[model samples]
Target chain A: MPKVTYRQHDGSEETLEVRAGTSLMLGALTGGVEGIEAECGGSCMCATCHVYVDEAWLDKLPKVQVLEDEMLDDTASERKPNSRLSCQIEMSDALDGIVVELPESQI
Target chain B: MATDEAAGLVVIGGSHAGHQVAIAARAAGFEGPVTVLSDERELPYQRPPLSKAYLMGKQPREALLFRPAAFYEEQGIDLRLGVSATAIDRAAHTVTCDNGTVLSYRKLVIATGTRVRPLTVPGSDLVGVHYIRTLADIDAMLAELDRVKSVVVIGGGFIGLEGAAALKTMGRDVAVVELADRLMTRGVGKTVSTFYADHHRSQGVDVRLSTGVERLEGENGQVTGVILSGGETLPADMVIVGIGVLPNQEIAEEAGVDCANGIIVDENTQTSDPDILAVGDCAQFEGRFYDGSLRLESVQNATDQARTAGATVSGEKKPYDSAPWFWSDQFDLKLQMTGITVGYDTEVIRGDVAAGEFSVFYFKGDTWLGTDTVNQPANHIASRRLLDAGYALSQAEAADEGLALKELVKAARKGG
Candidate 1:
């Protein structure tokens, strides 16, 4: 299992051990990290799983696609250069010890 | 509640609302622990199927479940199914479960949603009297369908009517009884409802309107017949009730949140307590801003409200302003509706109702209020767009059945 560290807005951290071949959204889910809702399951119909890939590990994940890009643009959170839908990011050994930041709002 | 980094989030339900809240919390950049408490053992699921696709047995369990196991694991969500929140402590911000475990949270989302309103008349607890709400209900209904050749549905609402239609298509002697004056009286206009009722009766369903059921009569603890309010008795081996639902807002009310018919929230889905939010059929918001001060019941409302709620959890204060929409599938017919049709003074029936491809367009004065389309997805799609875009329709163009909606609206515009 790879360890994923989630950095909170107020300078705190909650780490979860995630198995490879899972999504960052799932890692956050089973690990009990806060603030990822994934409303439409993983259908990409809803953008509740929005997250920001840590600046350092941004290149390690797959590129965001057109649908995800479209959804991210609709997210209430301001899209940053590092914004990504966590559901689409499959965890892997290459992404071990990665970090993702949460936006101030999701509505 | 203080913004303590150690305070975890605990969502007490596991379907549309619960799943969305967890994901949206993470999306909004919250940094703490998150846990989903669910009673059902199955993974979180899309529930629209329980009445349609799942009832027909065409959709598998995987098709209805939310996401795969790995999605939860990788998202770092602690999904504790087979668990339920038994009580709440507002001061401590903790939820006590039946298993004697207590989970603490900085903020809480009460997404308990709703349970199907049960039939409350005499013999309601009989073996053959059923209410179609959950997967278990459908499974029980499907099993009984094979042993019986006739069914008398006790309600004429959407679920009761759809169940009657589905069983009728299966070649059973199906009968529908409604206390209302027409089928889907709460949904469509009188004209459209009449047309649909005529169609159902023509298809061999005993469509009984203005009828109220008194009790389910039985022999040896099983259903045998129904006694109506008019003192008329009808024979049947099975009965399905679709009386509608009540919002599951007791928990929110007890937790000190403002709860009316549902958990009262604003357009942003924010409850009065600030620390709690409600969504789905369990939520009630501002009144008469669109319709006659009403709350809605549908899948579109659930998913859309979930999005708005999720966004709120993400820390944004966006109001839920998306136009409401809903769909229902019947035997060889698809009914799509948009907006609130309560205040329409004039309705123009486009195309031929006899041919079954027309739409009922409702307008209040000059503005388009809403529309109901039967078997015309394209027309419904166009109507939803035009209604949502705030386009007005002239009485002449709206009354003219020969003119296409596009051309009619274009010609009736201010400049034209």
Candidate 2:
């Protein structure tokens, strides 16, 4: 199991131990974390699950796909270099302690 | 500054799009009260999973809701479940509910969505014949799952293929009967259609192409088989119809809204009347994705239009100019498509189609039209950006397999 931490914009954080092979969005959603809308239900069609990956873990995660990047442009918040759609990031044993910060709103 | 009155913004139909309209109105600083009317008993839920996870019993009922009932209350939205807007009083700016409640609204959003197009044939109303639309329909079908050994799915559209895949996964014998020559004929090109048909057939689904279901054959008020146009009987204890859907536009039409195939709306999702707006599947508007007017039945269109409509009602006018995108999952293949492919002059295939990771890019003369990618999310995303930015790719450049599509999109953006 990979333990991921989801930090909110209001300086609150919640960590969960999610099974490998599931997505970060699924982990946050299954764990009842606020701010990740995920309206498309992990289909990569909606950009509601926008998050800012911790700078240290940015290069450690998989490369951002073009699809996820396009969706990031449509995020409610301004897109940053570290902004990623959490739904596109699949959890694995190697990435056990990754941290993601949620945006203010995922409209 | 003048204070805005506490007027009501009533949204008809509490599906995914309807819920968004209500939520967006509040999010966009609409000081008016928001009311959402739904005919279904449950709160706003994701309907896409109904044919797949929910039907397979893998997804629980609670997992279907887009947001909890508490979320609506927290947002100060008046969520009315199990009640429908029967009539729209355009002149009075009020809506009459089926429960005899008349609510006046300052702005009305019609997001009635669509209903499954019924199969009107002999024995169509037999007990085991089912249509997958709402959660109730899926639950009813699940109740008869154990008794059904074989299922004959009518249509080769997305819902039909998805339902067939789910049934096959559940160890049931399934067959997809399509009237068109290929699967997803109207949506995708011939290459994609054939690829999907072959893929579904490889997954143990009997893909019957160019076959019309003349009528259903039932015994003792229970469906037993489906009769083909050539009089061949396919033994099926269960029947799932995914032919298509018709927009629920009757209520809007009665209110004297301009409706052709669907309620015609402008770029802001505003209908013939400025106070009246339409979103989701029932709303037809001129979009940049296609040449003229188009009504998309996907969640992307629903969400996008809802945001625009909500913003417009709240005094922020944003045009619905975004390129349309859609995705469908069947068996193990995840297809992501963007833009419209109806009038492509040339087709370019990139990646290995046999390996199940390929994208077909369509172009008209020198302009990029759209793309359909199977298990190629990167290509789908890049194509959408290019289309949205009005970046055209020449036939020569799009056909080159060595050039990365993302890089091309980046270059197009820089050059444009």
Candidate 3:
């Protein structure tokens, strides 16, 4: 199992051991880590699962797709340079201990 | 309030809305025993993919679940799958289940959703005829797919077209029979409908419009072909019907809940009986976006309404005001719509429609109605935000493909 830390907008953090194959959005949802609404259920159709990856792990994460880049423009919160749709990020051993910060809102 | 201690929150239906109600209630700090009763044996799953990804075998059954099975236990939600609420006793604040179990609730949320309207034509009950409404329906259809060489899909709604597309992708001969003059007349505009019909035809699907299935021809109780109104017989190894759906509001209606086409709910999602609330496809809510009460059958409606109902149950009364949105994945095209496109007198097309990447911005005079975007996600999201903010783009601006919709949304927000 690989662990992922979810940092809330209020500066609180919660870490959970997510299954290797699950996406970060599902991991946060199953672990009850707040702030990831995942309205589209990992389809990348809704940008509600937007999260800012930790700067340290930004280079290691998978590159954003064109659709994701387009959807990032519509996030309810400001889209930082490291902003990515959590549903698009699949958890793996290489990406273990990755930290992602939640936005203020995901409407 | 004697029963309040033992009676927590009871939710009926395990679809999107019902599942969301439980999760949202817990998230809203409702510290009582939350129980969800679902007629389905499997955990609550996504219905949208049933005719697309799931039908194409791209997504497995596990992937269809809204949440992992263990998540319910962790949330203290007693998810009762394979059980259904047979009746609701409003006087006693109790629900009687088909399994002969009785459950009491402080607040009851009815998310019974809707069922497929059965095709009453002859041979409709043949073995090869199917309806795509549940996981079981898709699974059964999948089991027969290997043997099916040709399929005739009745109705031109989202389900029928998506199914036809999936079947065609699977190398099966598919024909879509629509009684209406255009495809998806109930949801999308004529332009969108025409585009889809043409697209399906280009993809080798026999798109039949203004054609009616007078009767089904069957061999040994299995559907073999469809007899058209003009006395033409189209051979089919299987038949899929997706005409429409009817809300499952029998229990609510029996309990004297105000009912029309669906269970009536206010902005707070509270039904006629204050103790009971209804959401999703089974709920007809007083319109905030359109005039008169409206019933929407989409994941967005279910999820948003459930959230509002959860808040109301937790004593946080937030009105249901989210703009309704829907999406469909057919072949390689992703169609996303925001707001209601009804009563639109004018439509603005952005991008290249010939290249299959464009959006139709519908407007009734100066009022913005909604937009239907194809292969354009940014426009879809921006349209939703614009509608939610009660802002409309000028006709000229919407027609200008050079202008990005996101920038316009930002400009609108800043202008306010």
Best by DockQ: 3
Tell me the tens digit of each residue's lDDT in model 1 across B1-416: 33323567777788777876787677667567878888878788777667666777655555466666777777678888889888777888787877888777777777788888888888888888888776668878888878888789988888887788778877889899989898887788877889889888889999889989888899999989989999998898988888888988877777787777888888777788776777777888764327534567776577666667666766776567666666666677767777788767888788789997778888778766778888765556556545545666566666676666655334444444
Q: What TM-score does each of the candidates earn?
A: 0.76, 0.90, 0.93
DockQ, each predicted model:
0.07, 0.31, 0.46
**Candidate 1: regions farther than 4 A off:** A1-107, B1-6, B287-289, B400-416
Give the lowest summed-lDDT range of ten residues in model 2 chain B.
B1-10
- Candidate achieving the largest TM-score: 3
Comparison by lDDT, 2 against 3, better one = 3
- The collision pairs in model 3 are none
* Angstrom error at residue A29, model 3: 4.4
TM-score of chain A of 1: 0.93
Which docking band does candidate 1 fall into? incorrect
For B1-416, candidate 3 gives per-residue lDDT tens digits of 22323788999999999999999999899978999999999998888889988899876687777777888988899999999999888888888898888888899999999999999999999999999999999999989988999999999999999999999999999999999999988678878888898999999999999999899999889999999999999999999999999999999989899999999999999998999999999999876567677899998999999999899999998899988899888889989998888888999998888898989998889777889999888889889888888786788878888888888788878987
TM match of model 2 to true structure: 0.90
